[model samples]
Target: MGKSTRNVKNSFITLSPSFFTHLLSVSPFSTPNKNPSPNLSLLFFLSLSILCTFSGICLLTFYPISRNSIPCSALSPSSPLSPFLLASLSSVLKDYSPNTRNYDEPDLSSSAMVPLPARGVAANPNISAEGRDFWKQPDDEGYRPCLDFSLGYRKASSRISKEKRKFLVVVVSGGLNQQRNQIIDAVVIARILEAALVVPVLQVNRIWGDESEFSDIFDLEHFKKTLQADVRIVSSLPSTHLVSKQSIENQIPYHVSPMWIRARFLHQLNEEGVLILKGLDSRLSKNLPLDLQKLRCKVAFHALRFASPIQDIGNRIAQRMWIEGPYIAVHLRLEKDVWVRTGCLTGLGDDYDRIIANERDSNPDFLTDKLNIAKSARRLAGLCPLTALEVARVLKGLGAPSNSRIYIAGGEPFGGKQAMQALMDEFPNIETKETLAREGELTPYMKRCSVLAAIDYIVSLSSDVFVPSHGGNMGRAMQGHRAYVGHRKYVKPNKRMMLPLLEDESVSEEEFRSGIKKLHKYSKGQPVLRNNKLDRDVLAYPVPECMCKR
Candidate 1:
């Protein structure tokens, strides 16, 4: 070693003849120290620091200034800017960050754990019919022009005094959904007729074997108060009132018929002072006047809110789903009943046909619709519910990322593990009510099918993206609700295109993605949703009644 510089411990640091002078110029001990320059000592340390930095070693440079040096000891080297530098470096090395203080770990825990649906339960036909539109006609998809609801709510010419009694009775014979719709029809008709509606009698459908009454589920008092101004409502008929399975008289006057004539004629015919309107038929969704349609919106969206308890559970689950991030609620409705009735399996082998035949034989009453429907017509009308496997393929192909948190909202998805096997790989986290709530909590809702469906319906209304697998009662209801709550993203599947596309396994991943992208492009916004058909009711978020946009 040269006399000017020497090695310390086992390592040596070299400095050129002029390095000592340069090191002193930049060193904290710039002023001459009482103990001398200590130039060689500072030079060795500075060189060591430079060498260690290039080798990826983050050496702590803030060791206190040397005691023997005056200027070095006078100044403290620590500064506020050093933390910023440390944070930047720590961000690059997040996985290996020394502590959590440097960063806020993203709160994805709730979304990471989705409420799981109870799979493999065959007894639960009580499942929500989320994505099934059982009522679409061939012309259901025809063009729908924009409506000017701004002026749609003009006062009707027939607003008679509430003191007049236009007493009416209705028979609710269908299951939950069909009857729910029928009630809306009845209320709208009663309002039209300026009638005092008797609390409707819910007949026990022998097929279901349940004897639940309307008061068992619906808030009867709320229903009365909600429609109070429009129509006077009572819960039951007097002993003198006659009951009939069929309409007591056929010609109920429509809006085009003079209201005065309807009031006078109906009162004249029913000498008993009450019109017993039987057979649940829908008039609210038909070609009604603008004022009535707006009124229907009011009844459906505003007045028909579920009891707070059902809404509470649904909101809690929804909040959990959204806590980590927003998620999609996929209306998965490929139950056994939907499968056989739709005849969507026509082209598949006899195994499917035999399976369908067996179901039909076991339950002759299951296939309610007697229409001679062709598979093509069913395809065009989107009658068929997609199987779980088909859904998985569609979702994967749609470019939904693996991290997507989806809730499967419906009854037991058909085919179980075999069907969901593909979807599990694509979306590892899929949950349901069984996963979210305890069995004890759901027991009360078991017999209340419509309320159970309403729970799912409420969750769906608050979803980031609602993908209905079949066009069913619950699906349509929530789709309408979503529109009312600012049209948050409702994706109506074009089953005509999706079914055929999924069976082709020959397609590459790129091709699959592109196909899904094109298919879903239609469902992203207001075009399909805005174009409300004569039958379907989601018109660009509820125009005048549900949403005022203020």
Candidate 2:
């Protein structure tokens, strides 16, 4: 699924010389003189040199770059064939001569085939002159799910009853993870209020910059089937539930995730039979009771499922993992956006201010109180995922076999190639959704992070061992999901201990391995989890207690 540089280099080797041969053959210098005429040859050489000066300009007219193309060095101003004194072009008479180069498809390939400036975007096309143009992502063996699953949803066909006024909680929120946690709260809230729960309106998250519907990313049918017994959900507010526009003008404004929202208040404080709720952000964990936490397991692990195409892709990847002996599905949380949201600046020099400033401007709806949280506190609270280096060390310390096939699931990391250098060296068998699925297959996901994350979630859930670099939304969700799916082992790094160990000069490779094993022994397959603190310490899959045997 990726273009190899070897092919491009071989193509260039075949063409660079022939083009030069054609150039010299059409010139006066192509003829051999019986008697060497210094003056004549000098005059001919000077004229040819003058023509070569503007060769790059003329070439651009023939090979116009639509997106962008790396410039060919043959026509460059500094090229030896261009009559310029190029120190790097030492073999001017042989390699860089007009008589030596002959690249085919000159009409299509730019002079450099990269580094060429585009119409709008600034570029130094030569930047890729020495390296491959694109990253190679490979496909994995196809496999089906362990069990048949259907991502289905049923349409709501009823309006609120006029005779009865049940509490209909309207949760206006955005973001996938935040909304998910709030849904857990909403379910419990609906139960407490003895109200008919309206199907959550999964509005497009401004922060996520996506236009997907709840149904587009998830199997609402599965969600409904799982939670139908505990709470009722509808697609929209019933026709009878709406109030006149005049009534809305005087309604109380939604307080967001109102920490004080109680079931008793549902009936006691309804304004004209409709309550408007907004800012239902879910950073706090105390709103839901123990029973609600158990319900969260049902909602998050069992009720939620990915849309069909994504699940299929994940299943195929999971099957590869199953066949390939074992694999580590790592949640590589190195996206620039998440770093900006956390305002962490350990190694991200000048990018720190820019990222934070961009987030503040783009996401103005953020909880203002969360802005001042310290970086250490964020890490402690599992808000920050490990940096590429930290994750590498932790995995290495955990004695992960270097030959293990690691599936990297998440967004494009921040440091790019520079960041992945060490981690990739340690484990070369890393794979991603892009490498495992074809473009047409991925078309259904539409390049959305949430959709891709669903694929990551499924793959990680079924992996031989799941490793989360951070305790972020995906990590927490997968850890819990893997739990419900029969206690698959999950590797939770003891970051507090591991970081210090990584810094110590006395610690050997063998010692690091021992520590990692010791740290994670109780972290996986435990029976008591759905406690949110599972992010911070050793508590695990709540399946045994929460889910009864089928």
Candidate 3:
């Protein structure tokens, strides 16, 4: 065994130089030297071929090195090799060591290969309890919210001729954040069509059966006032235009350009004088022009203010949380509907799996994931919602104290209070809207899901730290809102990296904790510009666009 190990080490040493040479030969610097000597060139090529042959033999003899067997010094930064070469070498080695691979190591060839942490683990684990103060304000990253719509507004207003200023009506449906997104898109669409927008009609929620109107949930007057300069807003369609109204039958395609919108609807709008769009959820493109994106930010952060009653109750809950000291808001998306829709097993064993399976069978349309991925594979892929136990473990691993105040925000979890037992045990100082508010305080909005979600939204926005067990509209909205207002610390759980570590029976507690910390070091709610090329939602990562450096 010792002799074999020695041979492997020697082989690796011998192969190293050939690998480095190969890299150099292919690099940009490998441009042919001028005035080359024929004899010297022949000799160089001959020697390079021999070295490559030797390297191939070495690789064949001992390619897969065991993590435990390899000496750390071989891969250390102190080596003579440049950092880029070292990184490349490490990546090559990593591709073979699947069993003991470090997921934290980024791929040198492609930055896109780096795993983004799922939405829950904190950025740093070393900060004290008072670290809450660190999140109250934006990071010192020289950027602030600056929605400059002056140019776009001028251009849009100029295009809106008296004959072309048609009326646009949108019927927005879904939960609070979904509707909020539609509302934002509705404004942008109105600008695209250069039409006066009628107050958005809120489709009665099928699940909650709540008949709350847009005016009931959001301050309509404020919405109109905030966009008065950008788009024309009206309470209702004009009597003459109502008869000429045309409802769009086909659902709009996702991520359409402004030109596509104009091409599709301009003629209809001109002919009919009014056009109605329904289920306008995520139909508009996320990668709109700067003005449109800024308008989205403006609508989301500024225009879409909650109604006074909802705001008052939400503020009361948030204040109550603050009184108990800084609290963390966790958007735990472990509801039954979530499980049914995601087709992800609850990790609560066979009985719970059967429950989810039965629900999925009863309503096949509920399952959003079309691909039939195994439950275990889905969990490993970070598709499953983190259970209460998993959330508790993540929080503890991130150094949140047992006494840390946590506010659970979401619909009732799948298993209800029983499902939350683990988290409650881990952190006793946990509260929900049901717990924080006085009896009958939330009674009015108890059945109103959107209003209740608005309450959760407010509390979440006020939190010193925000964590989402699953990614959704609310989480995405909160992420963008927090980044826009101030870079409040948001802990996106490194689920893809973390779940495997957590599941590995061989991993010790210390190893798991360290792994979790390392996975999320850069996953905090730091200021990052939205990459439009990647087609990431601007609302979730607004920087340098809606924001400007002072």
lDDT of 3 by residue, 433-456 (tens): 999899899888878999999999
Please identify which of the two predictions, 1 or 2, would achieve the higher lDDT against the true structure.
1
Cα lDDT, all candidates: 0.54, 0.52, 0.73
Off by over 4 Å in 2: 1-169, 172-175, 245-260, 268-271, 283-291, 346-384, 529-550
Using lDDT as the measure, which candidate wins?
3
TM-scores of the models, in the order given: 0.63, 0.61, 0.74
Model 1 misplaced regions, further than 4 Å: 1-164, 205-210, 238-270, 281-285, 346-353, 362-365, 368-370, 373-381, 414-419, 527-541, 544-550
Candidate 2 residue 192 Cα shift, in angstroms, is 1.6
lDDT of 1 by residue, 396-460 (tens): 66555566678878766555555556667778888777677765877877766556666676666
Candidate 2 has an lDDT of 0.52
How much lDDT does candidate 3 score?
0.73
Residue-level lDDT tens digits of model 2 in 322-346: 5654567788777766666665653
